[model samples]
Target: MLQAGMHAFILALGLILPLGVQNLFVFNQGAAQHRFRQALPAVITASICDTILIGLAVLGVSVFLLKIVWIKTIFLLAGVCFLLYMGYVMWKSKPAVSEDEERIFSPKKQIVFAMSVSLLNPHAIMDTVGVIGTSSMLYSDMEKYVFTAVCMVVSWIWFTALAIIGKITGMADKSGRLLGMLNKLSAFVMWGMAILMLLSLR
Candidate 1:
């Protein structure tokens, strides 16, 4: 069980370490909000979406996904489009320097966007299904449960830490210029990911 937990933790950490759409969105929300607590809904929503994906993957739903090429294609296309649109939005966004001016997303908007980024991302889906799901085949019963639990815990911890980091950085840089630069960088990253997915479609 310990070994399974360790494997799951390490694997999940590695998979999530990348600067993907979900992480970028979480970080942005954290940095954009007037208070770190305001970002909790986005963070929690994202983690929940990941939990669902991981759970589905462990249940061998990925096997069914693999059999349906059209479904994968449709998801990939949608992901690409969504990423591009989000990138444009981020690029055009202006940083808010004051609480009154801060355009923080409402809880509902945050939850919806978080779910979309986490659930609609084909790369994320593939990672959970392909890597996490495949890795689970080596474990059974309690070990499997431990493994899943560890992975889910890691997701929650990582997102919380990420939000805190963003909040700290925002507090330090009151000028908002750094946040603007980050938004542009995030936009670039999203567009790059979208392009990569588009290429893979062919």
Candidate 2:
């Protein structure tokens, strides 16, 4: 159970750290408003997908994923690099004080964009489905449920806070300093996570 929990947490961190890079950039570009508004539908969709993958893991899908050694390694490495690059982007990014706010705030576009980003992203699939689901298989059904519940709660808290903050603070205007800091912090987190994952691979 302890091992399963650790695996789930690590996998979640691995997946989320990279995803955060892309999201934060969009956030800095003032797309956060769009993202926040569309977050509800996007998050809901992601949750359902994650739940299904986790269920499959409980049914022994993880073993299949684990066997694809090269694929897992490739994804793991790619996820790490993507995060580091995103961090770099954030570090160099300035706040979006654009004059075209009205043009970019379409609800349907936002929701569709959110869905596409979260759903089609290979890194996300690997983390939630391959890593977390695979790890969850180490434990019994009860423990797997507990682990999944914890991970979902984590996802909910993160996305909710991000959307709310983006809406309230207006990432376009007053979030430059805050966004800069977040980018740096996210970069460090990603670098650390990547290193840890590499170590585990060896």
Candidate 3:
């Protein structure tokens, strides 16, 4: 069980360490919020989405996804669309400076964007479904559950830490110029991801 847990932790960390639309959005929310707690919706939503994906992966749902090419294509297309829209939103967004309350993400917007980036992202889905799911097959029964739980726990911890880090950075950037640059960079990342997905469809 300990071995399974450790394996899952390492694998989950590897999968999540890369920069992506989901990670950027969560970090951006952390930086944009007036308080750390205000960023909870994004972190919580993302963690929940990842938990669900990991759970399904362990249950062999990825096998179902692989056997259905059309379903995968549909998911990818929707993901690309959302990523593009998100990029536009990010490009136009201003930091949540005291004078620009309108720039901040409300709880509802946080939930929606968090869900879109997490659930609609085919790259993330495939990593969870292909890498984590395939890795989980190495275990059985109680060990399998332990592996799944560990992966979920790691994801939760990761998002929480990421937000905390972002909050720290936000606090430091009193002028908001750094955050402005970050927003533009995030837009590029989102658009790049979308283009990659579109190209893959070829």
- In candidate 1, which residue ranges exceed 4 Å CA deviation? none
Off by over 4 Å in 3: none
Evaluate model 3: give its lDDT. Answer: 0.92
The TM-scores of all predictions, comma-separated, are 0.95, 0.52, 0.97
The root-mean-square deviation over C-alpha atoms between each candidate and the true structure, in angstroms, is 1.3, 6.7, 1.1
Candidate ranking under lDDT, highest first, comes to 3, 1, 2
- Sequence-dependent TM-score of model 3: 0.97
Root mean square deviation (Cα) for candidate 1: 1.3
Rank by TM-score, descending?
A: 3, 1, 2
Task: Go through the candidates in order and give the clash count of each.
Answer: 0, 0, 0
Displacement of the residue 158 alpha carbon in candidate 2, Å: 1.5
* Count: clashes, candidate 3: 0
Q: Taking the tens digit of each residue's C-alpha lDDT, what string does model 1 give over 89-192?
A: 88987666787554677788789878878877787788899999999999999999999999999999999999999888878889999999988998998899
lDDT of 2 by residue, 1-202 (tens): 6765666666665566554533543343333344465445544544455555555555666557656989778766765665555445445544444554553434564454444444333445555666676666666776777777666665555555555665556644464566556556656655655566567578
Off by over 4 Å in 2: 1-11, 19-22, 25-39, 42-102, 168-202
- Measured with C-alpha atoms, the lDDT of residue 130 in candidate 3 is 91
Name the top TM-score candidate: 3
Clashing pairs in 1: none
Report the candidate with higher TM-score, 2 versus 3: 3
